[model samples]
Target chain A: MIFTRSTLMVLLLTVTFGVSFALLSPIFTDAQLEQKTFVTHSGRVIETSGEVLDPVYTVSTVDFDPDEFLRNFEYGRISISDNGQTIRDYTIIAEDDKVQEISPGVFFNVWTFNGTVPGPTIRATEGDLVRIHFINNGSKSHTMHFHGIHPAEMDGVFEIVGGNGGQFTYEFEAGPVGVHPYHCHVMPLEEHIVHGLYGVFIVDPKEGRPPADELVMVLNGFDTDFDTENNFYAANTIPFYYQHHPIQINTDQLIRIYVVNMVEFDPINNFHLHGNLYQYYPTGTDLVPSFYTDMITLSQTERGIMEFQYDYPGKYLFHAHKVEFSEKGWVGLFLVKDNSTSEAYYGN
Target chain B: METSEKTSRIKVVTSGIIPFVFVVLMVAYIFGPGADLLDLGVPLPELTIEKIAFEKSEIHVTVRNTGPLPVQVVMADVNDRIHPAAIEPDKFLNRYETALVRIPFEWNEAEPYTIGLTTDDGTRFERNIDAAAPALQMNFEFVVFFAIIGTYVGIIPVMIGLLWLPFIKKISKSKYHFFLALTVGLLLFLGIDSIEEAFDVSLENLGGSFNDVLLIATTVVLSFLGLYYVSEKLTGRADSLRISKPVVIGLMIAIGIGLHNFGEGLAIGAAVGLGSIAFSTFLIVGFALHNTTEGLAIAAPMSRGKLMIGKLITMGIIAGAPAIFGAWVGGFAFSPFSSVVFLSIGAGAIFQVIVIILKWIREEGDKNLSSAAVAAGFATGMFVMYATSILI
Candidate 1:
């Protein structure tokens, strides 16, 4: 085909502009308008149902179940010592940069022992030699400080272990049979404690107590905004988690709860049970009951063992007596089921 | 020969060792101390609420993840009360990802409400609406309200400025070119003003990633070239009995001024929609005064041509009515990117019209480029615009 120079120039310009425009159009267009499917870190392609908004909210498949935490206890590896003494060896790894979702949508940098806030509960019998092989994989220095009796050198406060793969062995006799708190005893203790560095330590007597449905409840608070005051309070790490997923228990069975108060920046926290009273041991130091009450106030790290039985199958509420704390998520419900009947009764 | 054989064997053994050593070193570099040394702390999540649309018994929130980490919207809360929300696409958002969260909430109008979203990491992001109101809909009342505002801001003001046509027609032939030069000066100011407004809007409302400067520049160039092409086609038909060259330039001036007024209307409507600025009689008066000078610019080019009342009125409407459409869109769905685009186009159109006016002035046999009367008229045109703008 014969063409003038101007016509040839126009054709060349048209092709160039068309190709460039086609390539550059996507840059100016809204990305949210396109429906895109993304593969998650676990290699799962997620499909969504229902009307999606202009920009879809990313829902997480990862869930933190508090049910397992309620009844979990770490007794450690058991063995006999050289001198015929019972020895319990435990490996507690301290990490300072672990990010945990303490509640829906809230992620906090929690310094953890064994990778969990209000770390694992360490249980041991009286006079058993407790050997904790501590590894600090965190960015900051840490130490295992037990609230029970130990040698001066064994105290975690003085011998500050260095950070980034620092190691320390804490060998101590589990004395004064009671419920105590084991936490990071690094200087500026509140900073360590508030970021979830503490856990429960239960030392039974030479002879164990009566068999019961035992559970651990660690009272803690998160200062999300770092304002020195807690924004949310909870039994475990997640706020209102237990309230949404009520703890199931059987009626007419003895229920023992190892309650520990580890909330910092607050003077005291109290627990109140609805429609129930129980025999409370002040520190579980003695087998005898200290008091019978529906509510009990505790200071920081104060702990006790409560033994009770519900005769009727129903839902009961348990929460902090402090209105502010309870209102801000320190609440839960216990769903007591009748063991005699096959049908479950769920109470609102 | 024995030495040569030994050397070959050594070379073979060294080649084998070299690869093995390299493999071990690569593995160590990737996964050993090197990995541990490069360990950066946990990625932080940031959520930004882009827009909130209040519907009947529903609040639709547009949220974007502006951080490096992926975030999941696990829960929604209205005034601290948990409400089940249906999130579109998925609740998990990668960095720079957007999500639409539709929450069924019974919100009272005029009452303040706080909407909170909780991510999987327990971070609560909250947005507060000081006064709750339904999003603007294309209803009868909405159309009438915008029309009234547009009429005051665009149409009436331009018609008032066109009252200068009789005075312009009575001037001597020697002084006639002065008015055309003045029209150029007025358009030049309007063109610069439109560009400045476009840039301001882009800077304030558009995100950094949009590259608003490039977008505005591209739109201006495209609009200028487009108008120039259309004017060239009109010039080809100037010999016909229907439209003349002067009339075409006059029409171009009206179209350019119309576009500029539309942008102005958008600003006013958006301010009212956001409740940032109140709609008052004083504001209307200020805007009317500011826009009257636009009509004078449009009429100046056609002063020497044959006058027709119908043509004049048509040009006036062409120059004015787009403000109504602008008001409607701005009051309902005010998007910053689109605003920047339209303002740039207006600036481009104005500049194109100015070029045609200058060319016509030179064609009229005014060989001297800078005459005293022409310079005085141009300065007067700029001064008039500045004086009117102070009221706004």
Candidate 2:
């Protein structure tokens, strides 16, 4: 009877101790983990036990959304021409007096096409008649020069559209089956391009390559201090925009990114995808894939098409391979979601 | 008596003849070729761009004409391309006139833009923005930031110094006079410092538009007379209530110190806004230390009075809150002319308070200002201010 009583007491005590230990362990562990110390760039020391996160996003002073810009393809007002040809009519307005906050507390005056840094992404299929009603509503002369096979007079160069409501019409046949950059071809080309007077022009093959979630990534930079050196870099116009609002994609879904490089005052810029390889189409000129890679280096106005698929559902990073550019607001993230869990996930 | 009257009449006649002869000579000179020589051809239009602001799709260029002749801007250009512009208050600018030229140009950020104004004579006056940046706008966040800065440098430090009131109250009667002398000494130093600062700002920032020396002198005299009149009125009303004379003097000291602190806040806020001074831990601490002595000066005279916590707090606020207004003005819309005027007013207020304190000290049985304690306190007060200033 004494042995049984002793055993019972030990069991009760042990169970009590275990339960108490289990309850108290999480509290201590959480307290340790929650206590965080952060040092700001301005050398302010902050200590917190609760959530100590810098705001995930700052309300941008400029109204350019990178996620919306990614998949926003302007097919223009399509119409059937008298010759039964597909005509894509676009009105490209060039303006020179728009101030944009490229980075936090750093603003830049960005000369724009259609009031945006990269302007609008104009898309056309091969053999289509591309007619652009160009308007210079800015304070400087500008012209839309597309990089493709077109007539001499149809070239944006040599035909300088005057400022203050100057108008011109550019008609051409979309011959080249690839992604091209259309920009202001006025003199002092670098000045026009650097101020964001450039955008993407994708001419799809008549047969069409493949259907995928299409996106546009225009890599650019801003010389905020006007020291002839870029102070900020980003995929779209605003810096660190994509990092704050990550692009969502479904797992195992094919992703097509039409990437263009429009950064001036720099020799080169590059893009690298984390945890995934992509089939790279140099300029998207050919139907077949040229290279399978996770990274690609581009020169000024250099561009390509990237097609990839994620096998696992998780967060991934896509940023400039150039460490300087990436550190200075050129980084972004992709949140790949499991398709089986949510069929209604929208890709950005 | 007849001879003296005749001499006074002759003196008055002689003074009148001098002005009549001067006027005759000036009229002759004006009629002669000398007046024609004064017309030195059409002087060049000297337009200075006071500010460049980018708003929406327009560039607002604030330009001031500092030339002797009037200028008419007929055309405006952006990057050598002529663009239509609307000049407010007329494009015809007379000497010392300012106009806002609004050009509807979609300028890009981080781009170098040269805004050129073509005068009627085809003479182009150009202002180049090295890089276009957004104009600083007043917002709630900016106001809060400046308030926090003012509280750090003004209110908190002054309150901390007021903590010395209990110790001040315990001092002997002989030393009480010494503390009053110290307050006088502190005000005197602050007055001279404010004058010097006002002169410095006028010299460096006012340009040639203002005669800075004249401006400072006139402002100082006006402010001094105004405060003196106000103090006399306050004293008359206080006498009816039978309030202690020292309490009135203490209130005046608070006002004086408050004015000086407002000027100090302006300098700090302007520096921070211009990005010339880094807002660091050391700067805030330094300003706090420098301003603590101002509170001590306010408390020194009040030691003899019945010190109520509410009165002390009111005095503290009176001596400190102006810094917040000053910071707001300096950070948002700093004008050098206003800064100079405010600083001179501060100097004048300080001088007015000094006179009141000295009179109070004399009435307190220290007939002559020759006491050893007074001499030592004055020297110590000046020394404390100088030492604390080194930290800033």
Candidate 3:
């Protein structure tokens, strides 16, 4: 009886201490976290002057032969800096496309980008001109199709003929700011896009990104059949590089994220964040400050923008909701910084 | 290890009409003037970990899965200082995602410094990351804290229930089975959803090992579970069937689970290779679900074994060991082909389970059947999705 009473008392005391300690934990104050400036302006990526095609090797990054020059390149992205400020990563081909370096999966009998068979997240904002100048380097025919947004002539559906070595200027007057996915809508789409050929198109909010910081991300997949590093996924694929990017944030500040699904065709894209939630625009429209959550599901050819404020700051993580996706490689991260009010509390 | 054992000793009885107490508490807390103080909420932590990086060095950290269920992870402070942050990514980091949160500090001059590592659940875990001395890689392992969570969800409920339930009214066999079913259901749901949810990653434009490996790995895990379920059902129950080698069959099931988890590990490896700590987490969760169910599956059969404790522990390993291995692999030396092998294996397991359920249904179509109940359950699940979707 004495032992039992002592044990109960000890347990009660411990719990009390723990609960009080937990409750007393200070809330993140502005002085504790790091805040960045949200700067949004116009960016133009045009070959109008025809000075340099940027002479980029439009091929799958997995197939990007560093030792050997990009000769008859199968696929890749056009690394044209948007206004020379940011590299507007754009997919260009298929076949030679790739998945992760560790698990290299290649989809044959298809045409797609270099990284993901479906390609990466292609982001843009409302009123932004989504202009594509393709040189048609594939064997057969191919065209671009905007699944999320609409276009009268060059929606790039199967109707257009993109034969061998042919090129076309695919342009879309940016529609309502939202997330839109574009894919290769040629014959046997399952094969064309399955191999590699797609990207994400994120149309920003009509006004602009939320007042919080802005992080535009492009997620996709690849198919590099021979690498042995990535050969699990047959069609859709997320590249190794995106997975290579780390997501870090400040705990005491607000954040706005633009996440778009660019894989030409595949898997339910469930984007989730750890330890934190976000206010999102479903169907990629109408953002209310209260739509806060940690997970957001994106269907094929979909886009979403998440915004939220951080009151508690600590180490946080973000990634795909799919358990195995990370193993195969679709993942990213964000780090939170210590945003404390003053050192007086902890004596730091 | 400890939490699972503790949860088994739970019992709940409510002679005091606990619901009334709950109502009173609710009224007192919600309607009372000091509601916030009396409620279950407490002040959230103020220290935010953001843009915390080895601004002058490279940091390598690994978060492990040590929980009964999967939990989400986000950006941790210490090694973060990015211009913009992706905090609360609309997704979760599964069980064992590890990341090298490197700031890529190119040292033009030598300086003394340290790196910080953070876990997603506000667990401020850090490592003294140093990179100047021949690129020394600092490794940090995650603490699952599964035992802690289990204590609250399982043992606490059982203890409270036991307090009110008549001491003479020990739990009945059927009640135990019902509880088992509930646990199974929860685990199964967690397993399937976690695998699906964990692997279903969608990045804008950049796709490769991350999505492909993860997708295939997760699908395989799902199929393995399915096949195993089906196979067990087809093999018949322990009562009437005289299997030539029951032990072999059980071992084979265990092996199949192991193989599938290995693939999940590969996915984790690939994610980590690309510096993705979040996706690794989901892989861990999927593996945990896979492991826990395995434990229950074996435990049900070995209910009467010499040293029941030993057998249960062994069974838990049979189911859970693979996950731990996979987590290590994913966090270390995982690959994609493993995902394929595991996917096929998991497919087999799932088929086994499905087969079992199908045969049972066919044999007892009307006996003890509750069509309304099943339909209601299905409707309820669908309604939740619909409601959430609508609200969003």
Compared with the true structure, all predictions reach lDDT values of 0.78, 0.77, 0.42
Tell me, what's the RMSD of every candidate? 11.3, 22.8, 28.5
What is every candidate's C-alpha DockQ against the true complex, given to 2 decimals?
A: 0.15, 0.01, 0.01
Error of 2 at A182 (Å): 45
Please give the lDDT score for candidate 1.
0.78
Measured against the true structure, the TM-scores of the candidates, in listed sequence, are 0.72, 0.45, 0.32
Worst 10 residues of 2 chain A by lDDT: A23-32
lDDT of candidate 1 over B97-128, digit per residue (tens): 66777776677877888887767665667778
Which of 1 and 2 is ahead in DockQ?
A: 1
Using TM-score, give the best candidate's number. Answer: 1
Q: What is residue B36's positional error in candidate 1, in angstroms? A: 18
Task: Give one digit per residue, the lDDT tens place, for model 3 in B103-172.
Answer: 2233332343333222223233333322222221224432132222222222232223223223212444
The TM-score, computed over Cα atoms with residue i paired to residue i, of candidate 1 is 0.72
CAPRI-style class, candidate 1: incorrect
iRMS (Å) per candidate: 10.3, 28.2, 19.0
**lDDT score of residue B10 within candidate 1:** 100
- The worst-scoring run of ten residues by lDDT in candidate 3 chain A lies at A49-58
